[model samples]
Every structure is written in structure tokens, then in C-alpha cells.
Target: MSRSPSIPDRPHRDIDSDLPDDERLEALRGHYEDLVDVNDQLSEQLDDAEDRRERLREKVDRVERENETLKSSSLYIATVEDVLDDQVIVKQHGNNQEVLTDVSSRIGDRIEPGDRVAVNDSFAIQTILNTETDARAQSMEITAKPAVTYADIGGIDEQVREVREAVEQPLAEPELFDEVGIDPPSGVLLYGPPGTGKTMLAKAVANETDATFIKMAGSELVRKFIGEGSRLVRDLFEMARERQPAIIFIDEIDAIASRRTESKTSGDAEVQRTMMQLLSEMDGFEARGEVRIIAATNRFDMLDRAILRPGRFDRLIEVPEPDRDGREQILQIHTRTMNVADGVDFADLADDTDGYSGAEIESLATEAGMFAIRNDRNEVSHQDFTEALEKIEKDDSSDVISSAGYFYQ
Candidate 1:
């Protein structure tokens, strides 16, 4: 019975036990074959994918490098197709290739085809660039050059005659001075009470002369910083030289030409320095017919005696208040276009308003016409004129006058 039990236990295959060596070897060989096939396919797929990724990366890097190059360049590239007298036409180059863009470059400057260049920053063979731009930008610069013609300004016959002889004639005929063996006057000073057409007279001279007008105030020439004012003066003269036939009009000459004080305050010293520079510039030996100066001042007595010297201001013209005849003419000039009433007498008006400057007369006429318009009247009446006089008197009592008082004066 014991022997039979042992045999029964061994009957079926021992499923829980390790396989035989031959069978184990065969199974392992089949698994190795499958692994090789899978490895080969995976390696091929990996090579293809890596090659595609590398190509994409190279493309992206190239794009980035190009973008960086474009961003870093300070130059603006453009194509030059046409060159006009004063203007040059150009197009910007951009994109992956040459493409038309809105960028432009100035003439007499250099730029590359399809290259970016700064319009303001570039090389010009003719680049002896004008340095006058900076000097001309001074805030207080007053140019003698004016836009008003002699015809444009009205009612200053005596003043105009003086200006013509002093400024306009000299500018128009440089040879006249040479022929007469007389050196041209260095400057002319216009002095008058405020609002007497002094400025207008200067404008007429500027318009008459073919000169560059450099207008400035005397006070503007003084600066807190040392040497700055002097440098500005030198630059201004240099500009006048480069651009010949220049007129320098200084408004309020008393500011720079004030009577020198013995005090040593910083402001006083600055003003003195500015005045010295102005005097030197005005009467400097190098001043020729190419440059002329005109200065205006309401306070002529406030100016230093040295500034009034012959060489500095060869002539000092007085622009006085307009007399009755002058006022009548001035009023007529300003009111020629207005719808005047039949009884409006300019002579009566002139007789009524005395000691009024040309400007005041014009203002009075304008005010009278405006009053008429505001009252819904087509014509300026004697009542309107009287009211205008009263209103002006109320505004500035000193300017208005009674008819009897005016005639008596």
C-alpha cells in the first residue's frame, strides 16, 4: 500500500516544479528573437524622430539669429530710386527678403540697400552740417529779418525816412558806402515810448533787406552760467557770417546796455558781461556791411554811454508820438475798409485825440467800428466814436482827450 501511494503522487506532471533545461532553452531563444525585432524597429523610429527635431531646432535658431541681427543694427537700410533737388526718395528693406517699407533717408547722406539707417545720424560727404541750427534756437534771439514790407507798415514817414537811410538803403546798396568812402554804420537804435510803431519800422527794414533776421531781447543775452552768453554771441555772429547779409534786431536794448553799476552782485555781473559781449559784437572791428544791427529801447537814458558811442550805434532815431496829421493818416489807413458814416470826419477825430501814438489811433478806430457792430448798426456813428473815446479813456485815461484840450495842446 505504501509503494502504490508514492507512485500515485508522481503520476501527473509536476506542474509546480521548474521546467527541464532543454525546454527552458527553447523558450528563451524565442523571447530573444522577439526582443531583437522590437529593438530594431524602435531604433529606426528614434533616428527618424531625432533627425526631424534637429532640423526644426536649426530652423528656429536661424530665425532667431536673423531677428537679433535686425534688432541690433542702428542703421536704417533703404533703396534710392530717385534724387530730387532738395529731397531724396527711399524705401525700407525688411522681412525675409527685400520688401518695400515706409522708412526714408535724407539726401547727402549714406545708407545701404535694404539696410536701416538713422535719418538724423548718418554720414554725408557734404555733411559739413550747419551748426547754425543750435545757435538759431536761442529763445531770446531777435532777427532783424521781418516779413513786413515797407508798404505793409503805414503812417511813420519821418521814422521810415530815417530807417531807410540808416538800414534799408545801406543794405540795398553796399557799394554806396564804399563809393562814398564812408564806413557803414555798425548799428541803429530806435527809441520811443511804447506802441509807437518802432517794432513795425524795424520789420519794414528787415523785409526790405535781403538779410537773415536774428531777433532777440537784451535781457535774454544774460545767463546764470558763465561763458554761455559769450559763446552764444560768438555763435550768432558766426551764423551771420555763414549766412551773409544778416540783421540782428535786439528788442529792449536797455536790458543789455543798462548803465553799468559798481555793485558786485551775481546778477549785476552777469548783466555787465552780457553787455560787454553785445558791445564787442556790435562795434567789433570785423563787423562789415554783411552784418547790421538794429536795437529798440523805450528807455534810452537807461543805456550805458559806451553803448551810445558812434561806432556802436551810429544813429539813434526817435520814434515820437504821432501828431494830428499823422494820427489822421493812421486812422485812415486802419479804417479804410470799415463802413464809416457819412458825417464821420477823420480830421475831427484827429483833432479830438491828441498825444495818441499810431497804434492807439488804430486801436481807437478798431474799437469804434466794433462798438458800432455790437450795437447792430451798419455804420460807425459820431456817438459810437464818442463812446469809443470814453471807453478807451475809462480803460486808459491818459490816452483820451477833450476836443478843446487836444486843440489847445
Candidate 2:
């Protein structure tokens, strides 16, 4: 029945095959285009996911580095609570771990004070605490300036000039050396009678240059501990090199630098070792940037011969006892604040002092004034100086001459 019904409607004509070539071709092309579009969209989505993963990984890496830095720093903390006297404290969050420290920290100092520090296991932020001694140690590292100055000292003009030229000028005007075509003198030595202003001259150099001044007695460098003294010598030179335009003032250098006797014991050998270290430091290499050494001694002859060699302690200057003019100047300077008789001629007083050093003159002037004050006199007179001189002569035989009657020879 169904076939008959279809035949009744087929009156109009040319029959086509059930599978038409054009229609099938069109359908297959459309299906292939849709698959290609789907693949492209999937590729785009995968690319975006990969980019997001990389970004996350970078953030994790940055956090890891910060956490590691915090763990390594002693001042790291888990929770930031407060800062007290250069100390930082942290309380751990959701964990029993604690950290504490008294060390100072700043922005770039690699410290972390929060739970964000947990990213690094190597360094952990545990707790916060204070070490008063450590705080004090950090505070005490300030370098103090040299206290003595040219104005504070009494005499020694030549010595000051030599230091200014050989040391101060060399540091301040390096171009001058090349311009003048003259190599600066290698070194300057201050040798004099006791209390003749040698040490004062060195201190004045430190003050004039406004340089970092490191002062050490010769005996301090002669440590009983083996190798310690030599090591300190090396450290001192290195520190001076680091702090350029620095002055190293060594007082009583004759104690460690005395004439080298034949070795007697290990102690002597150690002392020689220290001296050798100092020698090497003085002349080891090229012209250093801005470091000058000023050494003082009452006995120049007592220093080791090697120390006086060329290129090392090359200039030997005598800070001698004050002459008449020098004595007058020194007396005048010391008596600036004192009440003195108008007839008290410092010229006559200086003429009476032949072998006195500047220090001796100052002491004498002070003694005279003190005597006047003790007797309730308003002015220091020549007679008071004579009496004071007698009293000092009685006290020490070294002061055997009376002020006016006998001149020291």
C-alpha cells in the first residue's frame, strides 16, 4: 500500500538518487569546519591557563627568597609586636615556634616580622627578645675625634710646619705633588727631651687634618698573648687604610721600637715580630691613599735602625728644649689668664732658663702664679717666681738652679 501511494505522486518526472553528490559534499565540509573551530578555541584556553600557572610560580619564588632571607637574619620574627631599644619581637601565628633578637634591623637588613616569613624553612622567625650588652656594644662603636689641637698646645712651630707639609698637604693636595714635580717626604719623626711637646705636635696634626685619629701607646702593642700584638698591628694598618685621611699617633714608641738587642727569649722574639709587622705596614707597598703616622719618643737613638731607613721614618726632626724666644712665647701663652706684675719681663725670665723645655716653662709659670695666689697677692711678681723656683729645686735635684740667680745650662 505504501509503495502505491508514492507512485501516485511521482507524475512529474526525472528521479534523483538517494545519495546526492552535492548535498553530501556540502554537509561533510560544514562538519569539518565546525571541528577546526572547536580545536582553535581549546588551544586558546590552554595557553591562558599555562600563563596563569607561570605567574603563580613566580610569586611563590619571590616569597621563598624573602622567607629564606628572613630565616637567616638573627633579627627575624614571626609576628611583629613592637620595637624596643633596637630590638624586634614577633609572635608566631597558628604555631608554637617563637623567635627573639636584640640585633638592629632596617628595611634592607633582611629581617621579617610576620607569618609571611614561614615560606623559608632554613631561617625561621621564632621570637623577640633584648640583649642589653649587644645594644650597648653597637652604640659604643662611635669613633671619637681627637681632643688635642694646635691652639690647645703651647709651642713647637717647626714641628707643626713639618707635619702640615709632609702629612696634611699630601692628603689635601695630591695634585700639587705632580704639579710641583716633587715627591713628598716619606715620613717625619718627633724626637725631643721629655715633656717638650712632641706628643702634642702629633695630636695637633690629627686635629688640623680633621682626620680619624687612632692613638695607641707602644706598650699596648706589645701584648703578652702570642701573635696577638702582631695581629693588632696588621688590623691597625688595615683600619687606617679603610678610614682614609686618618692619623695614627703612637706615643712612647721607644718602648716597642728600642734598639734591637740580640734575641734573648721568646718574648723578645715576639716583640721583634710585632716590630717587623709594623715595619712591613709602614713600607709594604705603593703610596696609600690618605693615612699618616706620627710617632713620638724622648729617645730617638733608642729606636731600631731599620725604622730610620729611607722611605720609612725618613725625616728626623728634633723637638728640642725651648730657647729664649720659645720660652718667652710659651710663658706668655701659659700666663694669658694670670694676673702678673707689669715689670715681670718674660724676656728676662726666658734668659734665665737655658735648658728648660716648653713643658718646663709652663710648669714654672703655673708654680709662680700658684705661689702668688697662695700668699693672697693680686699679682705674680719676679720675687714670687724666685721663691717658687727654690721650692721646686729643693723638691727635685733636676731643678737645681734658682730662677734668677743661676741659669740652667
Candidate 3:
């Protein structure tokens, strides 16, 4: 800012020297106030210019950072497949193409098989990356224990015992296996008809043990693209290892362990790849510490022989429909809280339901209650039980007839 002339250097020359002394003094005071006002205006302009400079500096810094990011080289994800004396095999993700790259001594000391790493476009290892766990897999971990205990699961007592032996005993007393001079079973495979208490059995085991329970369905493992399924399996096992003494229950395992064929279909190939990864993780050379696997399936015939082998599933528990006695116990359990007349007998009800599953028995009790409500009665009578059984039987027969028309198994 330019300063306009306000007071002359020689005040006497600007004012009249012949004037009285008081008048001269007052004129000088006016000049002094004018200089002070000009100084204040210049200071305000200086502060505004500094503020503008600071904002521009900040904008320049952000642009510089963006430019640096654009100039940086890109990296791709890969994994170390094998390690040798000097050369290591690295497999690029998505493509599964393996390359033998020479690792520097410093990097080779840190790299190991199964470790995720970053590679350049030339497929050379650049840096080791941390293992990433899937959020879905982590969510499967049960924070609160399930409410279903062994006592709550009626019928199928034998199957429950076998599962407990396979899953619980190992975590409770591992030395029992060592004393017997046997490697504890790696997993237990449960096959049964639907609604036969297979899933309930798994929940019971989760309730009994203090281990982390991670439950995921096999259909969730099937992905739309290649390599994703295998990656998910890897992450799941990695999570189990992170939280030791964990139980991984995979329901409807037939979705992934189905019989592998030589067909060239992409879907089949991807599923097979996922199965191979599962097989490797189950009985691989790496030790499986304190982790137990329990898988259930409705279609045992659909499972691949490789997965059903002795090493993978040491114990194959078959959960069949509850026998007469089991059905009676299941009825007593479901009807424990129901208001039933004294004449209603569980033994007779069990006998009447010859092929009904445990689930069906529970449903029968519920339907019996609904019948009482419909009749505007407070207590369920024997007639209500008989009607529920007849209704369920009719529905079952109709379903069989409808299914038989179009499908042959």
C-alpha cells in the first residue's frame, strides 16, 4: 500500500511561523494522528496478504502428495508357495501362475511358504504382506455360547456321545489320545436325513466346550469367481489358528465336498479347487493345534470319496430318525410345558408316529396346542393329539406323492 502525504518533515514550513505557539502545537498534534491512522491500515493489509499465502501453501502440499502417489509403482498380491536354498516359488493370485524368483538374503530370511506378499508386474517379490481375515468368517465366531445344551437336544443320544468324544475330549484331555498312542481325530462328519437333530447336535457341542465356535454354511464358501473360495478357506483356517481351541462347524458340507468329475465346466472346476484347499488344510503337514472340525450333511452320497477318507473324517456319525423310545423322549421334552389332559400319553403318541423325525414330534406338540386354541379349550386333549397326527400324516403323504411325480432318487 502506498502512503499519501499527510505531514511535512518540517512542520514549521507547512504551518505559519508567525502564528501563536499554541496554534503551532495543535497543528503538529493533528499531523501525528494522521500518521498513526495510515500505519494501522498498512498493518491490516499485511495480515490479509499473509493469510492468503498460508492457504496457498496448504493447497500446494496436497497437490504435491497426489502427484507423488500417481508417480509411484503399482503392486499385485501373491503368495510364497515354496522356499528353497536361494530360489523361492511365488504364485500370483487370481492366475495361479507360479514363478521361481531369486530372493535377496535379507528378504529370503523373512519369507516363508503360505505367507502373502506384494509383487511387481515382473512377478518379483517386493514385500511381505499381512494375512487378511474375511469379515464374514470372523462374524461366524460365536461371542456368546449357544443356549442349546446336550440336555436340550432330545433323541440321538448316541450321535451326541460320539461327537463329544471327538470334539470335547480332545480339548478337555488331549493326553488321552497320547496315552492311547493315537492321533486324535481331525474331524467328525455327520450325515442324516433333514430335521433329525444334526444341527442341534453341533450346537450342543458348542455349548459344552469352552472353545471358540465358528459356524459357516458350505454354500457360503461357493463364490462367483475363481480363487475366491480357496482364499476364503485359507482365511477361515487362519482365523481358527488365531483363536486356538476353536471348533469350525460347516453345515451342508456337500455343497463343497460333492463328488469331483472330469467335466471342464468352470463352476465344477472352481468347486474342486475349493475342495482341494480344504483337504490340504485338514490333514496337511502343518500341525492343527487345538482346533477341531465338525461338518454335517443331509446327502452323504453326494460327498467325494477323497473327503470321506479315513484321515480327513476319522469318525463318520450317522444321525438316523429317532426310534420309538427316542421319539417318546422327544415328545416328553417338547410337551413338558404344554397344558395337556391326564389322558394324553407320550408312549401312545410315539407309537402312532412311526417315521416322524424328532423335529416332527415337536411340531406335532405345537400343532396340538394350536388345535386346543382353535377349539377354545385351555388344555390339549387326546383328540387334539390324534387330529395333529392325522394332519401331519396327510401332509407327509401328499408331499411324497407330489415329489414322486417329478423326481426319482
lDDT of the candidates, in the order given: 0.66, 0.65, 0.77
Residues 1-409 of candidate 3 have per-residue lDDT tens digits of: 3343343333232777787999989877887777777677667767777877787899999999965754487876677899999989998766678999988887899988988777777776777875343234333545336677888777788888898988888877888887887777788898876677887887777678766777877776774334457767766787777876777788888888988767877677778888888899887722235878888887787788798776687689988878899999999888888898999988898889877777778889999999999999999998999999889887765364334223212
TM-score of predicted structure 1: 0.61
Candidate order by decreasing lDDT: 3, 1, 2
Top candidate when judged by lDDT against the true structure:
3
Candidate 2 is scored at a TM of 0.59
User: Model 3 off-target regions past 4 Å?
Assistant: 1-143, 223-227, 285-288, 397-409
Q: Name the candidate, 2 or 3, with the larger TM-score value.
A: 3
Local lDDT at 170 for model 2 = 77
Q: After superposition, how far is residue 19 of candidate 3 from its true place, in Å?
A: 26
Q: Is candidate 1 or candidate 2 better by TM-score?
A: 1
How large is the C-alpha RMSD of every model relative to the true structure? Answer: 18.1, 19.0, 10.1
